[model samples]
Each structure stands twice: as structure tokens, then as C-alpha cells.
Target: MLDKLSLVVTAPEIVLLVMACVIALVDLGVKSRLRGLTYWLTLGTLAVVAFAAADMAMDGRTFYAFGRMVVSDPMGNWLKCFAAIAMMITLVYGRPYAADREMLRGGEMFTLALFALLGMFVMISASNFLVIYLGLELMTLSSYALVALRRDNEVATEAAMKYFVLGAMASGFLLYGMSMLYGATGSLDIDEVFAAIGSGRINHQVLVFGLVFIVAGLGFKLGAAPFHMWIPDVYHGAPTAITLMIGSAPELAAFAIAIRLLVEGMIPLAIDWQQMLMVLSVASLLVGNLAAIAQSNLKRMLAYSTIAQMGFVVLGLSAGVVNGTTANAQFAYSASMFYIVTYVLTTLGAFGIILLLAREGFESDEIADLAGLNQRSPLYAGIMAVCMFSLAGVPPLVGFYAKLLVLQALVASGQALYIGLAIFAVIASLIGAFYYLRVVKVMYFDSPITATTVSAPADVRAVLSLNGALVLILGILPGGLMALCAEAVVRTLAT
Candidate 1:
């Protein structure tokens, strides 16, 4: 039997695993096509898990369990809480959309989502290389299945195939990188790897070679440029609801693993990895913003926007260590965290409107589809406009502050190159803004395509309103969440 300390440390994972299984079994008995029973149970489970994670984060205790393969810390706990909430919101917005298309036939969506959240929990808590890989596989596998949930749809099936092929290749890159690190360091534990690399006895060439593959793998997961080939296709082809599921919450997990692998385990080689990140950031910004300008499909455009946003996150990460000094590590990493959280929040609302507009047989996935949206339903158009403005980094909205924080992190480094990078990022943002604002133009200025008023269920309506409000409210008063991020990062580094 496991000791009480281990159980307490892993309480959230235990709950998630058990409840996911129970929900799966309970869903077998669910007769409603909407799976109302399974849906409420999954929501209840997520709420409990979120509360537990938040409580743990507030407790401010760090524990290593399962032979130190896993850790429970404030940073991981906070991410878990946010991921759970993100999943909840995703389901709330997605269920109706999924049901309308008969994708809920087997009642697998709820169970698969629960399992995916469990994978995220594992990823956030991982302290060992093997554990991280395990978590990643679990999450990606569930996502592939979800992407293909509509078996009769060729587009979803094709998307699933592309996602699986690219995802598997990336995973191989990551695993091989881990193997190289283990061969050099003689340990799979993250802290042990740190100590081994810092001892200065290992072959620098091998470490750098391994670092290249590791960064490449992470870039793929983060949807950074060059390795972002799969994103546009997958996002455009997958069911919109599945697209949001794969796009949003999993990003938080990717951020967690990047911190674990690069910051915690490979900080001794910061100069090398930071340079790699800088190149990736610049490339991502250039490719993403430039390509997004030519896209007509809304989902494909958002997919490219995602790559550009990740460039900013990577830019903040690269600024964390300069001249072998980690003085700004907390601030830089916290800014990246803040940026990702806000990005996910805004993406949720943006996609929520898309899901809402999708009726029984309409896809509503074109920029032209949103023409004169303001005339159809002012509330949804207003929400989508808020999301678009936020994505464009317009002032008095969360995205503006998110960009400001990342750029501030870069400038705080006090290096000419980083300052130049900051300027370049500003240019990229300006170029990117055109596409985001284009959506607003279509919605408000263009002629209406249909006189039918857009409508959504009460839950989706209430949640979307709250989501839009939070984007604006958080921008006006950003200190609370900023402080929370700072504290979480500081505590994780302390341990």
C-alpha cells in the first residue's frame, strides 16, 4: 500500500484517474444522445479536481513522490487548476456542437476528455524523463482519437492521420533526446541531470546535439515555426470543437514540460538553449504573421496566430537567462506563463463563438460567414470582437498586457540583441494585427449573409459572456494574476 504522504501528494491524480474510469463506465449506461449524465459527472469531477489543485497551490508545500518521479508544487498545482478550468470551459462550449453533428454517438467525448485532463495532470507533475514521455503519449493519443471521433467524416480522419504522424515523429525526437541526456548524465531524474551537466565532465558536443533535438520537439508541441506544419491542417480539418480541445489546455502542459526540461534540468547550458530559442522565436514570428495574412479560413488564420503568440512566449523564455545570470528568471518565466494563460483564455472565447455559430448542418468556419455578424446577434458579435481585439493586443484588453509583459521581460535583460528582438516582435505584432482586425471588419462592416439571429444554450451563453468579461477585466486589473504567476514561479525555483 502507498504511504499517506504519497497519497496526499498525489490526491488530484488519484481522483482524476478514478473518476475518469468511473465516468467511462457510467457513460455506458447513459441513454441520452447528449450524454447529459456523463457530462454533469465529468464537470463535477473537473470542479473537484480544480478546487483540490488550487488548494494545494495555496498550501505552498512541495513534495516528491513515487521515488521522486513526480512532484507536487505550487507551479504545477496552479497549472493543473488552470488546465482543469480550461477543459471545463472547452466542454461547455463544445458539447452542443458535438451533439449536433452526431459525434456524441458513442459517448466517448466526455471520457476521452477526462482521460486527456488526467494526462495533463501527469505532465504538470512529472519530475522524471520517462514520466514526461508517458504523460505526453497519453494526452496525444486521446487527442488523436478525439480528432477522429466523427468516423464518417473524411476531413476529421485525415486530420487525425496528420496529427498522429507528426506527433509520433516529434515524440521520437523527444525520446531520443532524453536518451542522449541520460547516456551523458547517467540518470533520468531531472535534478540529477542538472547536477550531472553542471559538473562539467560530460561531452559538450553530445549535450548540445541532444539539446537541439529537445528544443525541436518542444517547438513542435508549442507549434513554433518550421515544425508547425501540422497545426494549420489539423486545426482546419478537425471538427471545430475538437480543434479547441486539442489547441487550448494542452498548451499549458507543454509549457510545464519546457520549464522542467530546459530551465530546471538544462540551466547549466542556458547560453546554448537560449540561442536556439531565439532563432526559433524569430522564425516563428516571421512565418506565422506573414502566412496568417494570406489565409482566408478563420481556423487556419488562428492556427498561424497561435504560432506567432508562441514566438512571444519563447522570446520571454529566452530572456530568462542572460550572461550566465538568472536574475530575471522569475520575471521572465512568469511573463511567459501569464502570456500563455491569457492566450488560452482568449482562444477559448474566439473558438466558442465559432462553435456557437455552427448550426445543425452549417460549418460557419469562413471569414465570410461572419459578415455582418453584428447585425445578426450583437451579443455574440460583441464577444467575438472582444476576442479579436484581445488577440490583436488592443489596449484595455488582456492581450495587450500579455504582449507588454513579454516585451518587458526581454528589455529587462538589458542586452542589445534582446532589445532588438523586442523591436522585431513589435513589428511582427503590428503585421499580425491586420488579420485579427479583418475579422472585426467582416463582422461589423460587411453585409449580412443571413438574417437569422445566432443563438446558443444558456450555459454556453453565460460562460461566453463571463469569458469575454474576464479578458477585459483582467486587462484593466492585471496585478492579481501577475502576482500569482510570479509567486508560483518563485516558489518552484526555490524548491
Candidate 2:
């Protein structure tokens, strides 16, 4: 008999689960005029969860539960820590927006966020297909509800519907793939499937078909090309707070899921999937970058940027597995992980600035809205500039190092073509830079069309400042985080 109680070995997940239940109960029973209470409680819980995760990281134990459906290791631990911290930052950036719009009191937002975080924890640690599916659905359902929280808004409703339909399709694809894999290998566990593949017991045709569907499903989640149609509308239409969470947490979860699926489950067939990923990477890079150049809405542009970033991560994963060198592979994995971290920081910072500029009747989502921002508030302008520069992969910024590491890993693996493609990617990044810089130019050079005013809460200012500064600090002193990434990649590969 499986011991349900033995599943949680780390305090982080335990604390999160307990807090989630308590928050649900409180929301059910209590009604208070203190609209911000739920927000604070959510923030506090996530903060404690992050601290617990950090403590567990220091101890460094791998945990397994429910007959290996859940497996926790360094990589999962670190990603969970990132997720918690990101959630806390989202709360900080979002509180004022919610309050100003009179959308603050409902406990559903915070409760759903906690539930999503719990799902993320499970997603990262999932060692079997069933667990992965369960986690993915939990996160997806919560995200759908979150997008529709502003129920009266037509855009929010439309975006939520699109997200739901598309997300369900992706889930169906994943389920079909899992079923095929089970038919071929007679197992639901990733390790067992991999073993079957390695032992030559799996049918190659069935495996390939399964992998195709799986990649398609994951591609949808990562917002890569061909499956990226929903990104721009969703990002643009969703509430900025929900946008921040979707932009950051879910991307990290998808990356972790990709690592688990590709790195572990498909290792025996790396060559096959590597080629597929390369095609996806190239398509995403071209489509995402080129499409972003034409966007006027900052949020939509960022949505495309997310797509391009996923392409870069896919580039690393493709190179890592195709060349069949674990060291170089891990190096590439670390680069991808580092890139995701930097992207999260940059994206959140950028969105934080956007949320600050948004008023009840007006949303500052258009690039032109930022004109003469430097004249309005130099500090806010400066922070936005830093975010823009980081996203553009400017030198001495964290994004540059991220790209450099991926390129270096590709070169070390002797994938000259991929190196050239990465160089092309750099050029595309420069093209993407034009819009980012245009925002800066408008902020510093162009005069405002109307009187511009900045009104953000102190907590938002502090969190945004810290987020912007940390990107630069990590950019300058990237060795420490890079080392940690390397360690995480090693542990992931060892498992």
C-alpha cells in the first residue's frame, strides 16, 4: 500500500499545502473589510515556503514518494524556490493594481496562485507520466480561471476561452502520447520507459509517434512556433497581475517539464528528438523574433519575446542531446536554466513597470505611452531602461551571458551549424532590440503626448528596483549563479 502521508519530505511543499488549505478555509468562512489581508497572507506563505526551500537546498537530499511518482532533487528544489519567490514578487507588484481597480477582495486569485504553485512543485518533481499529467492539469486549470478573474472584461473572457480551448487540446495531445508510450513499453514511469527503450523492447515507430505528440504538447506550453498562436492575445488581454504569473511561473514549470521529458524519458532516442527540437527551435526563433518586430503593444511584444527565449532554450537542449556528450549537454542545460532565470527577472520587471503606469480606465500597454518617461520620473525610467537592456541581451547584462553560455556549449559540442544559427539568433536579438530601445528612446527622448504621472506603491517600487538591480548584479557576477546552475544540471543528469 502506498503511504499518502509519506509524500512530503521537504518542509516547503508541506508548508505550502498547509497554507493552501488554511487559506481556502479562511476564504470560505471569513469576510473582512481588510481587502489586502488575503494578499498579505499569500505573500507570507510563499515567503516562508521559499525560505524552507532554501533551507532544504542547503541540506541537499533527494526524496522519492508514492513508488517514485514524485522525486525531488536539487533541480526541482531550486526551481520550486524560484517559483515561490516569483509568486511573492507578483503579489507585491500586483496588490496596488488590484486595489486601484477595486478587484482586490476576492480570495480566488491568491488561492488559485497558491494552488498553481503547488501544482508547479509537483510538476517539477514528477518522475512518472501520471504525476506529470496531474500536475500539468492542476496548473493549467488554475491559470485558466485566473485569466478570467476579471469576468466583466470582454478581452479577459475571450483570452480565457482561447487559453482553455488551446490548453485542453495540448493536454489531449500529451495524454495520447502517454498512452502510445504505454502501449509500446507497458509502463507509465519515465525511468521504466527509458529502460525499455535502452533495452530494445520498445517499438521504434510507436516511440516516435509518442515523442511527436509529446513535443507538440510541450511546445504549446512553451509557446514555441506553430503552437504559439495564443500567446500575444493572452498576454495582452489578461490582467497584468495574472499576466505576470503566467509569463514567469508557467514558463519555468514548462522548462522543468521539458527537462524531465526530454532529458530523462527520451534519452535513449535523443538523436530523433534532437532533430525535431532543432526544427522547432529554428522556427520559433524566426517566427517569434520577426513577429515581435511589428508589435506596438508592449505586452504582445513580450509575448513574442517569450517565444524567442523558448527557442534559445530549445537550441541548448537540442545541441546537448544530439551531440551525446553529458558534460557539454549539462553545460547547455545550465545555460538554458540560467537564461530562463534571467528572462523571468527581466519579464517581471518590465511588466511591473507596465502595471505601475496602468490606471483604472487606462492601460499603458502601448509603446508610445512611455514617451518622455524620463522627464516624468527618472528613477522609474532608469529602471525600465535596465529591464529593456537586459531583455535585449546587451553586454554586461545577464541576458548576454545567458546567450553566450548557450553558444559556448554548442561550440564545445562541435555543432558548427547550430553555432551559426545561434549567431543568427544573436542578430535577431539585435533586431528585437530595436523595439526595446524604442521604448527607451520614447522614455528619454520623445515628449509625452499628455501629462504623464507615475503612481506605484512603495512595495512595488522596492520590488521593481530590487528586480532591476539584481539583473545587473547577476550579470556582473554571474559566476556564482552559473556554478549553481552547473550543479543543478549535474544532479539532473545523474538522476
Q: Which consecutive 10 residues in model 2 have the weakest lDDT in total?
A: 1-10
Clashing pairs in 1: none
lDDT by residue for model 1 (215-252), tens: 99999999998899999999999999999999999999
> What do the candidate models score in CA lDDT, each in turn?
0.94, 0.84
Off by over 4 Å in 2: 1-7, 28-34
Candidate No. with top lDDT? 1
Instruction: Return the top candidate by TM-score.
Output: 1
RMSD of each: 0.8, 1.7
Residue pairs with backbone overlap in model 2: none
Q: Write the per-residue lDDT of candidate 2 for residues 1-495, one digit (tens) a residue.
A: 356534455457677878988887777654653345676778899988887776666556676777877777778888888889998998788767766665555678888899889888888888899889999998999999999988888999999999999999999998898899989999899888888888986679989999999999989998889899989989999998899989998888899999998888878788888888888888888888889889999899889988988888888888775455465788889998988888888888899888888853578889998888888888889988998898888889888898888888777776678778778778878777887788899999998766756867778888989998998898999999999888887876787
Per-residue lDDT, model 1, residue 101, is 96
Q: Which stretches of candidate 1 lie over 4 Å from their true place?
A: none
Judge candidate 1 at residue 482 and give its lDDT. Answer: 94
